[model samples]
Target: MSGIMKISDKEFYSLRSLILEHFGINIQEQKRTLLVVRLQKLLQAQGFKTFREYYNYLIRDSSPDRLHELIDSISTNFSFFFREHKHFDYLSKTVLPLLVERQKKRNSKNIRIWSAGCSTGEEPYTIVMLMLEFFGIEYAMWNAGVLATDISTRALKKAMKGIYSQDKIRHVPAGLNKKFFNKADEGKLVINETIRNNVTFRRLNLMKPTFPFKKKFHIIFCRNVMIYFNQQTRNDLIRKFHNVSKPGSFLFIGHSETLDTSRNLYKYVMPATYMRI
Candidate 1:
């Protein structure tokens, strides 16, 4: 009898607030109806006929999965292979060349990169392929690994599998397809385990005070993840990303985002992209 649930205004407001606190994402008033639609099934699953009960259950249940579910629902996951080609182009044409020179000066060949909110696996996979091309597989002996994280366990699982539908391969380069991807039994493109193992997937909530990584990175791709947060939260997260990077490291954001007002020690390289000090 309690299988049906409807979210009212009060419950919707409270849900929005908790989501922002837990995920650092700000939901606008226009999204109220959308929230109701998404949570309808979730409330039903919890055997609640109202959002009030579901919200209370969420607060009381301190299990990590509950929090993870809340985050997964609110987070945006739109990404594709070779997304925003300009950034990758920039990485190849300018950034990699510059970094090569910088590495020579530093007398070190270590390279570390992070793809924050790497939905599934597209963005980070694109990165490794480009890295292999830039350094040349034969000469690319430097220690390199991508640390990818997302709040969604479901997405992370798929990312770990490194399998994608044939439709998803269009944005990826042809050469990469020939070199790294294979046609699986399902007739879909499956990334070899070698590349998948090279990436370490972890569950990370960006809203936390500190990211648990010890080593600072040279480049971080946090693209499209900030659009969900409010200005203040966005500013805070950007500062956090900046603090975690070494001087001259790069942060790539959504194509439509900018840090003009939240500006700190980052110099603009292009729209929605900057280099940290």
Candidate 2:
């Protein structure tokens, strides 16, 4: 192991505290090893000789940009093409129909969806694929796509390009597999313009000063992202969700998460489902 391999408890806690203060996430005691293992990549980039030196630089000379990189690194972005397929199943059967009807009833054609913490953009693209499949490519009346945002700029960049391999597309449906994508060199699948056409990508840190958007989303999948945050931060995010989400809009959190803790800001529509209050 090299000199940067060393990580003392003091140094670990310092890094942990820095992350918590900036991103409002708390690391459990058991994750110390995970921290050391994961942060190794971060330290290697700086060619720092020790965790001590890196820790001091982050504390004394930390800028907004540095913390952005920290959040991008420290937080887990464990996502696949169509993770937890059941959620999309629900979206296809229950969510999309409701959205279509609601749009027509209100004589509105433009609808919006926000994929918060959209790692590499699979989730939002998945939503777009569903929309294109059900409503057809020329559904000019419903000019809706997705607004995918993530705290990680690196992830957002990859998402905007809209390319993935067979391994990543494992959970995608058979029909969608045949259409909306072309196999490129080396069996990598590229999302055709149909899926990529309307989806927009933005780099957003949820812990920032303001939510910074005026348009209320019809469906916002803030999924699997809040598990890293503390209760207060989670509650704050739910409040923001309420503000940004329309009355009947759906906010999907991670399977392991719930809105019960922040019930005042949301009304339960079903299990693991919520409506903004």
Question: Which candidate ranks first by lDDT, i.e. highest?
Answer: 1
For residues 125-244, could you state the per-residue lDDT of candidate 1 as single tens digits?
888888778777643477777899988887888888888887777877777887879888778888877677678888888888888878898999998888888888887888889778
Candidate 1: worst 10 consecutive residues by lDDT?
1-10
Tell me the tens digit of each residue's lDDT in model 2 across 119-151.
898889888887877777556568788988888
Residue 1 lDDT (model 2):
48
Clashes of 2: 0
What is the Å distance of residue 10 in model 2 from its true position?
1.6
lDDT of each: 0.81, 0.81
TM accuracy, model 1: 0.93
What number of clashing residue pairs does each candidate have, in the order they appear? 0, 0
Model 1 misplaced stretches (Cα beyond 4 Å): 1-5
lDDT of 2 at 26: 88
